[model samples]
Target: MYSLNKIIESTGELVSAKVFGKEQNRIFQDNFNSIWEKQRDSKLNIAVIGEFSSGKSTLINTLIHRNLLKTGFMVTTAAPAYLFNGREDYLYICAALADRKGYFIKIWEDGGKTVVEAYKETGPGLYKTLSKDGRSWIEYNEHLQFPEKLEDILAYMTTVEDAVKKMEKIEIFLPRNSLPEKMVIIDTPGVNPGKKDSSEHEMRTRKILEDIADTVLILFPADSVYTQTFEDFLNKNAARFMKHAVLMITMMDRVQEGEREEITEFAREKIKNKFHLKDPFLLSCSAGRAGKDEYWRSKFQKAEEQLMDNLRKKRERILAERTAGLLDNLLQEMNKTVDLKMEEITQKESRLREASVPNLRRTLDESYKEREWKIRAVKKQFKKSLSDDKEAMKVQAVAKVREELAKRKKRLDITKYVQNEKGLNAAVTESSQGMIGRAEYYCDLAGKKTLELKKELDEILIKYYGTIGAEAENEVQGRHAGSDVSVINSLIGNAITDVQKQENKNANSRDKWAAGIGIGVGLIVGGPLLAVGGLFLGIVGGDSLFVESSRTKVLNSFSAALPEIADKIEALLIENVNSAVTEQSNRLAAYKDQLEKRYQSVYDQIVGNIESQKAAVMKEKSEKEEIKEEIRRLKMNLEQWKRSR
Candidate 1:
């Protein structure tokens, strides 16, 4: 470790050290926790959704027992909701994050500000504050006036940009269930006049709901059955939501014996097959009061959970496999240029020895300025997409009044009703006014945003081309002292110099060979004559001395050393490869690291958000039991009231 690192570690309690330690702890946790959650978050896009009053809330209630959905309580239940466990899996409230095939669903308006408003409204963070007096007021107040309060909320519902912010600021409504399980539950406006009265919020809700709902659980009251409106909604928006729809037949308890099975079969034959769907599940349920006949409810709940779990796993595996493939392909490219790579690194190192390239550094610094700004801007947009969209605003305004009206036998609450009616009309009229104009506006904005991005892209193209051209110029004019051929030729020149050494060695060996042969010839030819002469003169000859000296010497003594001469060219070729390899390796690594780091944040953010969502869903799961308990209490209270009556 560096001295700084060691110091940080040794005295982590020191003020600066503590600060850095805390910061590093966060960084490391953020990085590792993000990656660790990736595989977990890669699960399927499980969207648990339904039309108003269909057991969407119940299913959520059953699956994850958090009673986040307000029924006969909250200002709305038609607002889409989501839940999931934090370990893995994710849900994007339609109004917020509508990402299709890894592409952002861009706003066709003023920076999607309004749409972003809808997103934030849908899933307003975990209701976490405490002791809010506003909480009781938001739900109801028998002491004051119920209809008036309804009217007040309804008037503001259509154009409330800061509803969520206002709701958060209030000190009264602490979340009923703070730790919710993480499965995205999208409760939407039921089909018909219930929503049409105040449909702008509904439409905005729908636009978002349609975009995010991969799987829609279309609910039908078993007693009433599927109406024309229901079928029309499904058929018209088949493109919007079909692959992930489960037709739920609710209120099995309301029907007689065998009706559940019969209705399910009828739906399969009439609806499922008509849509060409295979084994699309049709669940029979009651929100909280499906008594005695618990079998169907249990099965329904199980199927939803299984489907969600399975999808989550599937999505994760797919992304991982695909990302891995991408990495593999990139790694393969790095393996190329094995020889030339080393030379580049060597040159950079040589340059480092002399000085830092301030001009090159400054140019990169300037180039990144725009990129940094763009990165921040894109991140802000992304954050907006991830935030909440007050779901209740969409269908709540309509559903509340409709339900309240259904229970009433008398005339309307005229004073408040008239105000609500005006608000509803104003909402519809405002939206309708933009019908032609908004269509045109969307088209124009799409084109304008496209062009603006295209211009940026064009700049990128220019930069890319300019970079390529500059690199090409550098390559064309580039020089390498090592590759100068003169340097290498000099080394090769020594090979010729070594030739003299070999030649001298060869000459000595040749002379010895020649002398040996001559002596052998003389000895053989004059053997008889020499024997007679030697006896007479005692062998006192100078020729004998020369022969004796030559006999001791050997030819071909340099043969072993000559073997090394053949390997010189091969060694030089290897050295050339080594010289190029380092630079090329460094370049490849730098590019890879840059790309990985560039994408790392996005990946980490995605994973963190996804895992967080999963935890929320799991919380929902656990809370389902709690909801059941509450229902049990409610049911008991109902029975006791009946007994009293």
Candidate 2:
């Protein structure tokens, strides 16, 4: 039987033995090092996501057996909280600054005293603190000597609008002896909070699920299981994460004893029928009464045991499978490299025996011309495809903006904005912000489309030119043609970066639009109404008519602006898509020249070295046979190791 570490060690030894060329060896080493690090320190990240007032915080508190997290009806958990097992309690709070930096404050108990420290993120994962005058940052790690308690730090993680606006996230360390060692629980913000910023919250939580989470727990309050909002959320986003999801019904005590089983079955059937999640992992727990009530404690214990059991059984198997897959890929790549080298040697030997230098040069030149013509055709097709996609995306962007705005208009409470100028301002701000959010959503979609285009273009290029050392025609290629292929890949990568850059720039412009439109609408509607004796009407007890007139004017103005706002968003999307397409087209226009240069270089080398190559063909033929044998042995070993798992 072969162990994982042993397999990794063997692969590393082979990669380090100079079996591959210099560039191949470097790439393999980097890949191996990354997988090695993952194998060394892999942890399961379980993200808990739900709507507001869904008992997420209470469930986490129950899991950790601590009443540390604040739980109530006011959206207590404003920022994501990462809970980890530790020997003692510690809290780290990160606040976002106006300059797009982070201010981190770490609080923990040391020597029976509460220690507090502050730092700022100067780079990714690099923290530093300011000097005495706050003019420069320095690498100082001493405690700030502030007598701050755990409760004081927890306030920063609350839903106070000011605090929530500035907060990035919070990290909590708990002394949970029963928790699995490699398990981290992330309590994310409600995906559908009852606030104006629900879209932002949903996007944030969705990002966590897509990028960081290994498993997910979607919580529903037992008494109100599967509400319309819950169903809507699952419909829009559940398929992406359902493979690793657990449907948890919290606050089970709120339901009657006899109805709990029926409710559970009903909820399970609903999810199964709608989301196609066969036999989803569903659990019921009363987190609010976790420790105080015996019945609830027993229920909580069963749920906890089931969750931990699943994690324990799945984590090691997942890691092993991933490691095996990476190792297999590495071996396959190495085999390809060796095979290409052997093929090059064999082709050179045959050409030396059969053809004169002049004949070979003429054959190579003809092949180069044919390949260049085909490449030009592919480039032309790629540009046309990109242009068509850009136009289609523009139309799609306009429709999406209109759809989002229409939904906002339908959901607006006209009466709420009729009271005063402040109310009207809130309405305008909400509408504009929603517009910005929808534009951002479209930008994200466009970014993904750009990547898909790049991938398709890459596949087309590789199909025509072949991969790495394997060119379409054998007569005009070199062993290091992979370097030129990599240049093409780099150009595609730059196109992706350009799309993201444009997306960010448009986001900033949308922010400006949101601010300016909100203020402009407020003044446009509120000024004339007040100036035309509406205030006097209120003083004379005719306020109802004045309020109605104000509401009508505000609604009319907003309705008129909707098309203008949507048009602005559509223009931004078109600009971003065009920029991405143009950048890729410009980069790809150089592909023909690059390939030509590579072909010329290889042609010159072959023509100049024909006599030397003919002299060494016999010796190189024997070496190629030895290399083939070595590759066969490595492939056999890789298969055996894979089977050993």
Candidate 3:
């Protein structure tokens, strides 16, 4: 009802995903496949093994309620034989073809899937008809054989060639509802027999013991306590291969009735402790001598029931243990990854803490102040130089203007053009346009001078910060000794280098107009020229407009506005320089803070991911340990129960 088979299958899949390494994963996957194949509507293979002349065949014959196998006067069951319950009689034999190897053609419902040419007649060569359920039958012939009676089966198995057994294995199917549904009783060739093919028999027996025996039945004779050879065989195999084995002490009738209990106790104790057999069977197959008896029949039946019960319990135990074993390996593999990652994270955190410089905020403040002082000092020196240049430019502009005006006033013959008010107005407008052009040219020169001075200041700031950035890198490497702060160093270092190489095409570059310095004196003085024609028209119409007064108005505009325009231009240059200088200082000041924030963010992300993964692994490991412990306790309880019984 528990469907443990399903659980076991699913667990294998789960372990496959969790286990690491290609080979390791593949091994577990194969183990799961094997477990499923052996458990899924599959037969329990009970291999009957004993010395020659031991009552193994007789015991089996009596148990199945038919003389289904040869008992006396045979060459010790020359080949291995498998007995199963079938609706009709069937037999299969695999014979040695060449080089100590054997091959048999398997004829199944699927129409001869395998054909081995090692034998003379291969493939479905003997079968005449397949049943409605696809069960087939074959005839006795050269390469294929099907014997109907048990005597014929015995005669076929005893056939030999070149001192080696011709037959490899035999399958005898009997119609018996009393046989366990999913069970196959394999009657193997007796070990340590004095026969020519004894080595082959031993080899086959050992292979079955190692590979496929779910339950091994070790038969001994009650007439003799234990032969040295049989004891040695049990020593080598019982504890190693027979986790679900039973020690059957046959020939009990040969011993005296009074000493039966002593012999039984002696054999049971010897087997239970030495061979790890919890229960050693004591029964006699001597009833086969006078034909099978009801008493021996009942005894073998009872023993068969006990063996089936043990098989059931053994399967449950083995499944639980196998499941636990795989889960244990999976847990171990996962723990390796978990522990390694956790160690890396812990070491990183430790390194970070050890390398962390205390009073980081104070350190940042000090570094900021150092760069701030350099910035302010450069600005002060550059500011003074800029002011001096502006004053000199203003003096040159004033001197050039005054000299030009003196020469223009002296050259102008105002009397000639005075009679024609239009000519006089035109002359005055032309002279005003010339003066405005000179003022704009001077303002343009002043703008260039301001850029050159600012460029020089910026270069100084760039050099200072470059030095600061280099020093910061050295400090970071020294202080955070083991911790990786490469990202932080790169960001700050790159910021400084970028500002140094940043193209300042707007600074002192020709064809690059300074948008900050507006039209200067041109917009103000040029506006009066557009109105000069209106003034000329008014005067020519004799509308009380004096030509000389108009001349005075135009000349006064240039002379009076020159000083005011110079001051405004100087103020605009000062404002622009201050802005550039302040921005540079602020950027340098924030770099330290930005680097700290970035480092903290990366550190937090790494720690968070590591902790999350570690927690999950730890939780899973804890749960697996609990399951393992419970299974351990269950096995312990089972052993205690067996001992008590």
Candidate 4:
């Protein structure tokens, strides 16, 4: 199961659902479920696709001799078939992904029972290319060749040539068995054969081949120079499976020595000079019954052995790449989270230092200074006005006394005159006394106001500069606190934990991820349903181009697999993101509340101080007015004596 080359396919398939939104995921899942209908032994899935006489089944029979499929030099098995697998008294069923036409084998033991199973054929009821042969059933791609058994191959080919075809394909259904199956070899219809059925079968084969065949086993019959079919197939689509393809030249024994040597040399030259291939063996062998001339068996075994070893290397390489990618993504995400936290803290600290507590207090203090300056200026102006008014009143008092004296002098005979003058003077004197008193009161009020202003200003300065909230805030320079500092802080702590936590998470968005899984009815069952999706899977069986090289195969597998890993990873990330946001928003709200309280407290203090200063100035002015009234009477009496003179 683990050696599944399809693991590459499966991984790609599983993760793709997470990639193209839920829509793509549904499509992929739908396809997989629709197709992956069979169970098989834990056998290697060998998809044999080629021309009608490309010896695809012959190769399979060669591999599984004990269960050799009857081959008689023409097309024999018409439907896709499986190679039975057994190990340790356990039988593994070889089948296709319940969805697609390609064959694979897997093994399973349920309660110590071993059996192989394909979709139970309910009837001979046919749907387009689909057919049922006894208990196991599947649609047959006609291009898939059974031509190694000559008579059957000719019968089928003749039907294909005749064009009036009834059977979509001649299908052979193997009996059902429990999977954990061994290699299920898929034989595909030959492409571009002269017969009409050949075209029909070829098209179906091409669809599957282009779409889902993970690895292509291209068989080139030995002793024959590369044909246009081979050239065209290799040249046109070599890139698709450039990472993992197997090129096999069968029937090497047929070639004479000189021809054999030339062919061998031709193969080597074709690999290096034309195809520019390396490392991958260009094998020559025969897929016919293992007899005196069965050279291909040895080559097949060698190829199988090499492939098995290469499979491990490939798996390890894939694991390494994926693991590295996972680690890299984790590192990136961790760095981003940490950077965000630090940035938040830095901005807050900048605001705290450059725009918060200190600036707020500075603004308040500057306002206070301006207010104090304005008050002092106003008070000085008032003081000068009071002083000037006092002097004017004194001058008026002297002038009135002189005017009264002149009146008394002009009316000599003193007693009546002086008494009259005194009466007049007394009346004038009463009016003058009120004005003088007002001036003196204004002077005293201004002086007392000045004193209170100085005192209150001192108190306000002290208060603004004081207070624990302000002090506590000023101390936090965005650095860790010393002594009783919170040695373990949440934000910083989370970063450390994230760094230490190396987890391979599947998806963060549980809901969305789950949605992805349930999106398509096809993938819900998990198999290849590429037929429904119109995938060109049969291209591997295109009549002439059956032997694509190895490098192409590996690349094709990689291309199919990697994106799935990324998708699943991203899904998990998005899920986590939602949770993080929810949690962080709650905590942030609490902090905001605290900030609001601090702002309000400071705001109230500034407003209250301004109001208090204004009230004090008004009250001081009122009290000073009272002192001026008493001073007025003394000035009025002096003025009266001058007037009597």
lDDT of 3 at 126: 44
Q: 355-409, model 2: which lDDT tens digit per residue? A: 3334434444454444334323432443344444444433443344334333332
Compute each candidate's TM-score over C-alphas: 0.30, 0.43, 0.44, 0.33
Root-mean-square deviation of every model: 43.7, 37.8, 20.6, 49.5
Q: Write down the lDDT that model 1 would get.
A: 0.38
Best TM-score among the predictions, by candidate number: 3
Better of 1 and 2 by TM-score: 2
Candidate 3 global TM-score: 0.44
lDDT of 1 by residue, 1-645 (tens): 122222222222222221223554454344333334443443233444334455555555555544434444223443333343433131112222232121111111133222111212223342222213322443332122112232233223212333422221111111233223233444454434364434543464465444444345567777766676657656765433454455667666678877778877887677765677766656566656532347765755665555555444343333333333322322232233222344444554454334322343344445444433432243233223222211222233344334433443322231133224343333222322222232233323333332343234334323322221111111211112234333333433343335435544543554555555555555666885654554333223323333333222111211222223223322443333333333332332343334334334443554465557556545544544443343344334434433443
Candidate order (TM-score)? 3, 2, 4, 1
lDDT of 2 at 156: 45
How does residue 478 of candidate 2 score in lDDT? 14
Give the higher-TM-score candidate: 3 or 4: 3
| Deviation from native of the Cα of residue 403 in model 3, angstroms | 99
Scanning candidate 1 in windows of ten residues, the lowest lDDT window is 100-109
- Model 4 error, position 439 (Å): 94
Q: CA lDDT of 432 in candidate 1?
A: 25
